[model samples]
Target chain A: MALQAGKGLLLKADPIAAAFREEVKLGLSKTSRRPRLVGILATSSAPSKFYAEFTRKQCEDLGVEFILKKTGAADTGDLGEGEGVEEAIIEANEDANIDGIMVYYPIFGVQQDHYLQQVVSPYKDVEGLHFKFHYNLYHNIRFIEPQSLLTSTVPSAASAGVVESEEPPPGTVKSIIPCTPLAIVKCLEHVGVYNKILPYGDRAYGRTITVINRSEVVGRPLAALLANDGARVFSVDIDSIQEYTKRPQGGADTSQRRYHPRHVVHPSNASLQECLAISDVVVSAVPTASYKVKTAWLKDGCVCVNVAADKNFESDVRDKASMYIPAVGKVTILMLLRNLLRLQQYKAVN
Target chain B: MALQAGKGLLLKADPIAAAFREEVKLGLSKTSRRPRLVGILATSSAPSKFYAEFTRKQCEDLGVEFILKKTGAADTGDLGEGEGVEEAIIEANEDANIDGIMVYYPIFGVQQDHYLQQVVSPYKDVEGLHFKFHYNLYHNIRFIEPQSLLTSTVPSAASAGVVESEEPPPGTVKSIIPCTPLAIVKCLEHVGVYNKILPYGDRAYGRTITVINRSEVVGRPLAALLANDGARVFSVDIDSIQEYTKRPQGGADTSQRRYHPRHVVHPSNASLQECLAISDVVVSAVPTASYKVKTAWLKDGCVCVNVAADKNFESDVRDKASMYIPAVGKVTILMLLRNLLRLQQYKAVN
Candidate 1:
């Protein structure tokens, strides 16, 4: 068990801990003179508990103060049957002591409709779901958010426009690419992966990337990012991929496989074989009760990432995976801390 | 031949042209009384030719003007002798007619030593390579280098300090995350690829990610971005990997392969077997003269991206890959254009 735990730590815990420490130190150093207050507004016991412990450890190490205000879960039946959580959130917005606040709530529930636009002080709205925060992000305004992914997308999209054209915007805030996808790119960097045969520092250009999903939150932003980074991206909506693949093949054959301009498939109509057959990397964002992808469906030596939570896949298949990132696992916590620190820094400087 | 040409266009030309037009229109509409003037400063004719035709088509469509000024290839003797291209760039910098300037030179050959800081006007430095531009990026003061891998690491580091400690410097600007990696996260967002499935307007929260890299330019910034998005992240570096392998034993289970974490190899000593055996997604940045990965080395259904620009690998392993992103392809130009537009927008607002 100790060995397994050690292995787990090696595989998971240590990196997160190290990142947390590094971020905390940096966060604290940036605000060396001011007493910074971080407020976490959470309704669920789980997230609040995690934040309390994690923040406590981080604060203790960095000599920073962290406050957690538990507002209880979103009240599902307050305003017009299911608007209680929004009201509670609005109340929290008025709190004077909070510097940054994140209201933790499930992605779906009875309260989603009413709670989507709940008011929170922009400065205090650390989670970045507020209209003001999104507006700032979409418009590339300098502001604070709990996570970089939310705020970064606007900049990332804007920058995508730049790399694709000769004339980029002047004084435009460079796009802030999404964090999760950025993490994957970071993984490649850490591993020293570069364009084949290029010397160090040589830019990687002209790469072709096929994205399986097209969500505004993830797929669209990622496409913009890849496009910006000089990679040719083919974005296939999970719902409309077949239309792409039905087209005739085109382009030079750089690899073993011929270039298929339209290789995407719609999951609703796609056969498992077609969905998993041709991809070099398969990133699945679908939320399914069980594994939507199987080992048999995968190609050899392919890279796969299931960004969904829940132990939805088969363990045998997972064991054969090249890499696996579990939802809310140890690694995820460290990433969150690092982002939080960066957000604080942005708020301080801007 | 026409079919091949069409395929080539599908593979490269069309997307780039499309991206160029979209970016120019989007970038110009956001700013400038007249059509924005984009100046191309190049030593080589490659980018000049591409941009001339690409931007011209877009300009004609939008009634914008695209300018090309060539310095000719810098004297190899001067470049080899360590004289920088600063002098040549100064001409473009001082050009009154130039609204935005992109200095395209080989990464090698020319001495960059402070040349990035010396020649290009910050306003005209649409590529965002200047120190001031980088500083602005770190502080979130300006968004210029949209697709460069360095964007995410710098800003995230600063923001982390602010978010965790709530005491960022009064006027410090946060770092910007890298563009390409962040794109993946954005892609996921567009597809609603989350465990909790938050509504479109609801605050996005309680998510976590694991980053697998540590490159200063790519990994560090990306981690920071994830944290900013309110997702917990676990970051793993190459130094920490341990390698082990398992084989069938005792014939008890023919179908099951033996597993061992003990055989995990450090990233430095990574063999093809060790690296691909355990990873879920492989974002290869290894600069190689040939394809470093083989079908046999990869696990079934691995997602692999060859970010290297070298045409080093064999073209027969498509069956093993789920997706592949080539290096230095058409997408980069799009990203550059988008970044320029974003920068312009930022300037307009601020």
Candidate 2:
């Protein structure tokens, strides 16, 4: 195996995504009103805090105003800090200059993320994590209300919550897809896989992708995102990997339909090895500290991404693959910031 | 292959779903306040009208109030009938007596459905298509707020849109899954698969299912639902099914985690036949009218549910399968009505 120590295999959103950001920023710079963003963290989780700080710095670099709302135990109170968090979110929602609002995951050291998310006006929900962003996803990005320069993915402002509004034809909305999923897409584009073979940049057209872990925030959404691109996605559990691999040679197969590619393999080494032997791409959402990635069965050309902070793959696992993205977290921040920039510019254009 | 006639194959709701619905209905009947549901259709499509009428009849049978607001050409007048449709939905949402609100597809014709969906308050969104329903899917059905007996998947109401609500522990919330997907799950359960093997009552654990469409409404959501149940799902397209089956089979395999199990097959009739030979379930969300299902390669005992209205499978094809669901539409309406009953009862309990 040609194990080049960090040459070209580690994927990053470079020329393509960065170029897009520059273009969006240029348009935004010409606008009189600068964009401002808010970051709300309700937890003491190191990862959440780290991400919030990362976002703050990114905002500064982009010349966007960043607001930080941190809620702790006493502040949240015994009844739960959800109320206090709600008040802060509502305040930001009412802020005129606020162009985007994002909550670090596990809001308030708990999974209250969605509760606080709905409070932020969809107009500023550049992350597209809000429910309105999802509702609007049914419509093409063009129909998004309070329209600015829509990203063609996130339903723009004007279309937000306008239920009675006319909808574009089906198969048009690109899904104001969540940030992390979009980041993966951007990475695929960075690798020249998107706009080449597949649409979501997973380079997954006619390809098979295996996603480890079934997370609402990452694993499932990532699988859904890839499945949208006509690729076959396999889902498994972290604790039960070996068992899934040995169970059977064949698992479930969907009708090339978008929602049909999640599978919990019969955790058997044979099944695991079987999946590895036939995979085109693999995503490790949960850190596999115990699993020996180097000995894992996988195609030599398989592309991989590790989204978790803890490194799952062994040192040589990266050696066997064609490419790997060690920077999914950073890419997520960059992509989110870029989306915000594009959205702000879209608002200006409107 | 031995094919059973109309005797044992067509899959429909089993005793479980019916039993659940009956229990829900019993609760609703006991409640002093009758559950009132409203159906709004903005098109003349025979299908839409038929569905509305079917819903109305079902409501009558269940002892619930059903209201039909049909907005056609004259009422929706040009500009895509978006404006007029919005007003009607808003009115319905504001109605205190309306327990649930549903909109037949093609609100102003040509899939302009979302336009009419957003105006219905989340509280009345019985269809479970709303983003609020989706975001709130994280909460247990019991905790659904505003004291409405929320459907299990949609999360109850009092905490509806409350941004600062307390967060439930992760992975505890049972998804208030969409109606159509639930219908398929029920069919699986009816066929003795769900609880027999899978917890979703679909016997999906370790099973492989091939979904045949890329529908946002049916295919993707169905895949997600099955993924939640730990089933191995393969997604594919109607046109390129053969080609996909022929693609090189080394897909990207994930770590022994969950949610990554989509595979592109080698596509030999041998391979397609192999998948069908091994599959436990198959669902065709869209009508594969052009595709011949008679000569289609499949196993004998594979249970199938065709969600599309068009008869994709030839008459003879049904003769070979262990079970098939010919009544997806009927089942969908039944499940939705049942959900309304459940929600009303849940509301009463609150």
Candidate 3:
């Protein structure tokens, strides 16, 4: 994908998502029964409705069973906002046939919506928002025994700081990563941002990237994922700009070191312009329509990915950038499906 | 506390620890029954034994019930190393009389010892090394309902992005912080590192700190705690230098931000010299006896703290530092006692 004069390659999520889609289809084909997914839509918001429809279409295309459980205002205006969301989640959690569960967020906004996230059983938590998964993700514990979830004890891998193999250990499986972050990672990998020869855990080493927005679902985890894989991630949020990295300078003796420096946060005073000036990749997930990444500030020939519903980059972003991916929704959906397939297998062993 | 020519104030842990010891004593006075803490010592290491003895004396002086449960090598030379530790933890978990449980770590080194950490019940986890607490710590969830532990849910505060009050909500209590990190924060607060005039969560704002070592027990959590409290923390480890910070540069509109910008990780290329030059406070927890912070590299008038059993600072560190705290062990013990009291209340409510 070479850039044209004063224009970059406009990349679509289709090819990246399509590869994962095939993998999910292959996973579904091996399953004894079609995996079932329950999506709880508690709000009448347009985005939620659109997402539910999109999920349904994807599920139908892949031959996976998907049920959209619309509650509260999403179902009927007569019902209170976010009403019955908890009950719906409980019902889905109890249904052994339901291999995965996803909730359309922002129904009751931040706090209550977060509470609803935890309400979903970890076994069926396809979104990977549950605290258990979050704990593993943040700590960089990549693999876990599915049966261990039933036990109160967690994997000691995070504390152990051992260099883990890409392959899961005996009787263990890859832990679920949040779909959006996973999607972003997969997209980056496809674009050759993750150097394949640079070892499994630190594949993105030597790359400095700036991620705009530090939202829990996307920005923060994406920053963590990239940093864990050895990218310098500038985590741009509303009030702060934090740098995330797994690399430490001026190395000390590591013989007795207990914990691997998993993506540690550092305070940065660098402005967006400063970050963009040096960034090889700039990913913007800032949701608001007004937010825009100035093309002039971007590093020449950088890769720009727009993750928000509205374009976070200016119209001329591609003019300076080597490649621009407008959205990752397709890749995210496939990642969710992949998680659903994994959860099904997880349920089988447990 | 004026610094002498070519020397700085040598601050002792006793004075700072004494203040918290009284607070713990006051908390103990209110309890109808003495809070019982079971210390599981599975390691025969000299340091572990010394720590066990230290904890016993502290508990004895404070009028709290302390029981030392020696297992494996700590008990019998014939027994295998780390043997019976899991069983001992299970026994403590079942004991209604035990308000808290703490294990002497490195029993079987990092991995197995971490597994032992999880074996200790969250309700009885005085060290706050449990995944639940670690999740809360990494994500900056300051409070949780005690009864919520019984359920599968977690605090939504981290995802909510709301500016939390210092006081826990009506039905909730302050979540247990890892004792060592809490002690460090308390010591900093005592020495005027934390600004009382600032809002509750971001007290360590406007400070740049360098924490040597990214060990699970001390260095990592301490960095997270400081960064979450609004300090720019550079987490220095054997192989990497990562920046930890809550503050972001080039602020965005916060109207619909779903998650508060928690302590974020950024990869830094800075050497120890560079970090020390800019840092207002320098905390070293590097375990090796040979490793030392060069006296000449430190920022002028910086507060120096040594958390390692072996001093990490050069003998002449005080020449440039404003104050130097050699150890926090005494303060850490008080924090443990405080957690025990809190756990007692947490258990009662649950």
TM-score of each: 0.37, 0.47, 0.56
Worst ten-residue run, lDDT, model 1 chain A?
A1-10
Of 2 and 3, the candidate ahead on lDDT is 3
CA deviation > 4 Å runs, candidate 3:
A1-4, A157-161, A250-261, B1-121, B124-350
Highest TM-score model number: 3
Taking the candidates in order, what DockQ does each have? Answer: 0.01, 0.02, 0.04
Give model 3's docking category.
incorrect
What is the C-alpha lDDT profile of model 1 across A1-350, one tens digit per residue? 12232121112334434664576566657764433344433343464456557655755566655655443242232212222333344444444444554444442231222123223433444443433333232222332233342221222222211122323234332223334444544443332322545432222233434555554344544443443343444555533442222122346455663222212221234454664665444555554556466767665544454555544334544444454433323333344344445444444544
Worst 10 residues of 2 chain B by lDDT: B240-249
- Please report how far candidate 2 places residue B70 from its true position, in Å: 1.7
- Which lDDT tens digits does candidate 3 get at residues A1-350? 44577799999999988889889889888989999899999887898899999999999999988899988878855565566776688778877778899999886544335545656778899999875676577668788778766544345542423345789878879889999989989999999999999778888988999999876678877998888888989998776687887665337554553224577666678898899999999999987999999999999999999999999999999888989999999999999999998888898886
Error of 3 at A288 (Å): 1.2
- Listed for each candidate, the true contacts retained, as a fraction, are 0.00, 0.00, 0.05
Q: Where's the lowest-lDDT run of ten residues in candidate 2 chain A?
A: A240-249
For candidate 1, the per-residue lDDT at B135 reads 30
What does candidate 3's lDDT look like per residue over B1-350, in tens digits?
Answer: 44577788999999998888889999999999989999998867899999999999999998999999998878866455565676688778877888899998876545335545655778899999875686577768777778655544344532532446888778878889999988999999999999999888888888999999887678878998898888889998787787887665337553553223577665677898999999999999987899999989999999999999899999999989999999999999999999999988998885
Q: Write the per-residue lDDT of candidate 2 for residues A1-350, one digit (tens) a residue.
A: 23466533655545445765576568568767777788877655677777787888767877777888775532344323232455456667666678887876664321235445554555566776654454343221324334422221222234432222235334332235567877876676567555463332223556666777765456655665564444556666643332111111344453443331222122234355676777777777674556544425768878877777776666666656788776576667766766676566545545
RMSD (Å) of each candidate, 1 decimal: 24.5, 19.9, 16.5
Q: Model 2 scores what on Cα lDDT?
A: 0.56
